[model samples]
Target: MTLRAYPVRYLPGEDELVWTGGLGVTVRFTPGVEPLTMADEVDLLVVTPEDFSESLQPLVEHKDSYGVATRLVTLEDVYGGVFFEVRGRDEAERVKYFIKDAVEEWGVRYVMLVGGRNGGLLEEKWWCPVRYAHLDDGSNWEASYLSDLYFADIYNPDGSFSSWDTNGNDLFAEYSLMSKDILDLYPDVYVGRLACRNSYEVEVMVDKIITYETTAHGSEWFHRMVAVGGDSAPRAGDPWYEGEEENKAALSYMDDFEEVTLWTSDGSLSGPQDVIDAVSRGCGFLFFDGHGNPMNWATHPPHDEETWIDGLGVGDMRKLSNDGMYPVCVVGGCHNGQFNVSLLNLLKIYEGYQHWYSYIYKGEVSPESWAWWITRMAGGGAIASLGYTGLDWFATGDGDQDGIPDCTQYLSGFMHVNFFWEYGENGRRMLGELHGETVADYINAFFPTTEKLDYKTAEEWALLGDPSLMVGGYP
Candidate 1:
């Protein structure tokens, strides 16, 4: 099949150009504060009139599918070649807008561009300054509702610095000073700096240093920063899944679980309400497997809008104020667990959603690994609550027969077992561990009348598993 391409060319000294239908136009610009290195590959899409309809169909159809704005470019017959300027803005934004506009305007479909110097557009908007500061006072503050703030002092380790403004005052000035220091140390870090209105702080200095890489200029660096750390929520089965042997092995492990419900689909949760109803019916754990984006729920295209409470704002998906009792929700897809504080601000406006465990993966992930993780978790393994492994298993053909495709497999084998195990084990472990009762005592402790388990507090119940597991609560 012929693929469409978006070609972005840089022309030095020329403001614009005139192009016939067949000739390519040049875009004049430079790399922002941080130059695009060999590591940073710019994606280009080129589209012509022939494929315009085909190129735009999916985007137009899925407009609010992910809840974020998607950009499209339609290039007119430039009576004169258009000027793609990247002056004044920071490097990152400059490049981003230039490329974004190019694709949106010129009907580009395929992306191929030379890396480094004299070829691609140089833009300024991409640069943002990085700041480091030690708060004068030891109080901690929330920088922004949905944004993440990194706090650390150059000198201290344990208690050296904090990001609190005890007086409820904005800490923009203080933040700017620290940012200036970061800029001074790494001039190419960002195009410029801005003070944070909220005084959010990071407790660990090591974490602060690492966060700077994310806020830096290049896309490669930003993606790398987001991919770092053991922050990803765990999956159910073993980390490796081959053919039926692996599948049978994984399934055998799941025999200990009392109940199991497996939901499979391409990448959307078409029956979230049914699952919710089951959870409300006292199903303990809920597992979802499929393709997922960072800020929205993954469902099949032509989403069932009726399921979402109209006009309800968002914080957590569970807090949508549905009549059913919320089960422990687990998303086994890529990026579902990931949350940005900035995005949270958007959710808080809605009433029905509140804070729930949203374990996120940073990049592309496969359904097979998800399947393995789920099965293992269902069988009583402790892998589901720790670490992120983004897209590492795609090359392995771990679970699926055809290998895992990039399309969101949101509800396939990945979501089935994990949800089953989590819900089944919920209240039982609580009384046994929290009350210090023997396994026999705990077994006998179940109420004969209701067959229900009781716990004194949520925290005590939540501490049933190894305290070290990072993702979900213990119980």
Candidate 2:
């Protein structure tokens, strides 16, 4: 299956293009200081939209006070010279070049995309870069999905471009999205997106981050983890049923916890009300493992012969008044964190080649999509989230053919390791570091073993909140 590119005139609703849609800037980047340099290795870089640049100061300062090194810069600084020059080049590619330079020159560890994405209209606004990732190597129509993993996987180990285009097509990040040789697979650097639409949304997120880190609210609640499990394999007796997400949730939450409250699809905890109530009541962290779509988290109950429950959606999440008490929700489900690209783009690229459209077209654009809505809610939602951007694969998550329960799904395992292993084992208390550690841990596990690199399944997931937000220990 080949990705067919159309000329500008051939595309429909040309005005709705999000990429290359930012306003032109006349001035190029002139740091004024001779050759830019940072005395210490850079740990975090905040790329804010020009409009919301100043408002991010407090957040950056907060990150600094924690002894975590960070720098905040506007898109203009990187793009330099008139808006048209920035427009002339693909913003995503240009941004990647900047990141590549930072990685090589400044010893940068993490990059944060500070704005949100708008699905309705693709007018000039904050940038939300998109990448084309392959699901499998074969002629799989569904193989090519929209992703932002391209930005994360910058180079190959051989010093050549892994380019996601293993076939060496001019189209870099396409089918066979990431090459195992791309050490970035372990992700040399971590990335996160704040997903804020405006300065107000930015305010809401920053407030949550600062308060969650500084205030002495219920210190007692910080250790309380609410683990919600979803559907088990359609048929219980089967060894492997859709990756055993429900089972993973229980063990993952209990992985390092002795006092945490673990909720499952059991009759009492699987209902929509139960999940919402749990989130509303607030907890140190939240976990959900089950089937998911952009619109909602749906699961089939193991009980009744054929009964299912309608799980919570982003709209339902917005309805929650968790006050200032927010939990870092780590969801092990598909499309749980599909921030920028959506089902529509998924369909457009694979439209003629696949028959999956009917089942895949469940979500629309930005404001309505699941990931951005929850993380950017006006009052309370997750301060940060670690979830999937596209369909999550379960079969090979634990090496494709391992025994049931013994095997781990790609994302499920990542979250489990992040909280259980990475937290104290690696000493990463910041969300950004935890996220990077999570992916790195997963890569370390699968790497060196000769296991085929399955970047799509894991790379599809990402951090949907502020990268610098602290994980557990508070200041």
Candidate 3:
């Protein structure tokens, strides 16, 4: 796949957040000495780097209208720039302790990390540390993934030690080594992340949040969902695409909602203007599955019989007709959550470590991953999006042509279905709890097993927006 350049969307006054700051500070607090009081009675705490801490106040204030007692704190404010020198502990332990204290002491129910998780490589202490998981991959190699679940997994049943690195191996999120009693599959404290790389990006996001929340939107508009499923594999020889049948099956959970099925638009994924037009009409939820990346999703729109994939992308955000109404988009695609950019990742792409699953790979122009761009779109971005930071694991059969190769046996479909079921059917509202509940549901369904695929699946997927933003069910 070749890189494609598309027109970038711009929001006026977005340049105000550009700031210059480098890693040249000294560590302040010593180990076992985070002298912070957890006496503040707040429901939501927004965490950011100290540089952007001032600007975040406005965003926090705007979110305050939502009736949640929201507060803003810098990582330094929480950690005092201290690096915990414990096994399976690092700078991220600061956030862990803060959250633990908030949950234990204060009435804090939600904690939102409001900056990028990509820490600077060379530093005595990490900058905006992200929690990590050490799950063994199916390939037999140990795979470490960025996980927010760590902060939420604060204490064990005994409430003695923070069960980060069990077996004292100094590795956090090693599910195999960690004691089960410590693990909170259904985390009591809800968690979220902003995932912005810079203050400018955060500013843009803040503007969107203010505009979205301040304006009154129709509840029925949100109840109207749109499901788009693209070909999982090249339907070069056949007319109909793969993944639609099962995707439609998964979409059935939202049967009551006024929805548009793009996979079977006029009965197939090849409908000419179905999805492009569907977005123009407002909806509460958007579900898409198929070959894709952060830049673009694959679709055999209208013509193009030889599986010439032309699909939606970040560049198309400007052209979208949806203005104020933002849906919660769930993309069952690969690498839409690969928010960080690096030259080394290009090399990984060549080595198949970073698989480019779509036709239109991201070029130099687009600001963030298409997955995130959906939420931050100037016209109308969703409240939240869930996608894979890496490959969305799916089970494939051994050249079986007897029937439709049902990939729904994979966790991707189950999670996708469970998400809708949690929202549409179960009447659950908040994104993070829904995410946790879905993971817990999947685990409960497939318990008494050591399947690496299921474990790795939960580790790689993430939510890309506000977790506490409740999508109050069908009005």
Candidate 4:
């Protein structure tokens, strides 16, 4: 069998060059070219709908006063050709192009997207367009999942525009037999989203950010960390406490903080009330490792995958009253970050039982994902959260033949724990920086491919909070 060479062109006239066993080789280096148009440097760029701009102003001011150098631009500014030249196949692409320009022209290091479904729960309109990745893993009900990483990965290693749709089929992030786009999977700029469905939510989140950053410093609650888990996959055998092990890994990295463990092994995590009670007390960080869906996160009792333990659900968010002391939550599960879900899906489901099953694969079938609800909760809930937008995967055994269980290495379990590791060991103070660095580090450690779960692992994992967030608040 002969191997086919895949050539990538980063600049013009690259295809014209042909090297045929040259007698002598010469290398030339050129100085970097300056930008043709320079704009005011912006450290954090907040992209929101016009309706949200007013609500987000306080957040911008707070960031500026804290020396983050933030600037707010609406979706209108991007699409109307007011600031950035409108150019892309769709609105989502156009938004991505604007982010690319912001990185180069305005020197933007972080991007915060603050918008969600524009209308009521039954409406399908979006305040900020979302990009869906068409990476089918056959086992999952949905072939596509929401991916914000597309906006942050601006360019490939070759310096070419990293349009996720490299095949030009307009199907972004395809990783199936039908189509596959080789992605760089490296974040050029740190990106996060608030996914606020309305202006009220925007105001609530802005207030939360301001209060957290300004007053959270030196608070004893900020030094506490809550870690909860149960048996994630008992079928895998042996330890029978995969969830607890993952949580322990995160706690290991967070040695400075007081650790609070609620595990099935100890019967502390018997029900959702346990989670609600623990979170109400307030802590700097919350790590939940288990199985999850759009509305709830659940797990099995130790060594028993059949019996389910409803850990936490969207409905339980309201029970939290940890106001002024919010934890940055990291959830290890599936569909917890599926921000595309809307109330309109219920209408489709009401049509009939047949349509209900069919619509599940098409996506958008929930009022809100667990991560979004937690972040948008008025007085309590997590200040920020990271979770998967679709079905998550973990190695059953030593899939990589690396001696250690692959589940503990580079899929859902590893990504969830690494966020804390990056914060504690690597000293990634900014949430987005920690998130972006974690993605880059994961890709570096496990070379992702179209057929491998690694690609989807990196693509589907998303952050729901300000990318410029200061973990444990600003000092």
The top-ranked prediction according to lDDT is 4
TM-score, predicted candidate 4 vs. hidden true structure: 0.89
Cα lDDT of all candidates, in order?
Answer: 0.23, 0.59, 0.62, 0.82
As a whole number from 0 to 100, the lDDT of residue 217 in candidate 2 is 44
- Summarize candidate 1's per-residue lDDT along 142-220 as a digit string, tens digits: 1211110211111111212222332234332133223311111100100101111111211111122122212222322
Candidate 2 on 84-126: residue-level lDDT in tens? 2343236666676677666766677778887755443323333
RMSD vs true structure, all candidates: 26.8, 12.2, 14.0, 7.1
Answer with 1 or 4, whichever has the higher lDDT: 4
Better of 2 and 4 by lDDT: 4
Clash numbers, per candidate: 95, 16, 2, 0
TM-score of every candidate:
0.24, 0.75, 0.74, 0.89
Q: Model 3's lDDT to the true fold?
A: 0.62
Q: Tell me, by TM-score, which candidate is best.
A: 4
Return the TM-score for candidate 1, rounded to 2 decimals.
0.24
List ranges where model 4 is wrong by over 4 Å.
1-40, 119-123, 349-352, 357-365, 398-405, 448-450
Model 3 TM-score, all chains together: 0.74
Q: Which run of 10 residues does model 1 get worst, by summed lDDT?
A: 222-231
Residues 1-475 of candidate 4 have per-residue lDDT tens digits of 2222323211111212222343553556454574334466899999988988988888888899999999899999999988878988899989999988888789899999988877554456788888889988888477888899999998886666789998999889998886788889889899999998888888999999988888888999989999988878886545537788888778889878998898988999999899888888889999888888788888888778789998888878888889988999998887888887776675665677886666564334657788989998888998999999888886444443445554566578778778888999988999999999889877765563323577888998999999998887777
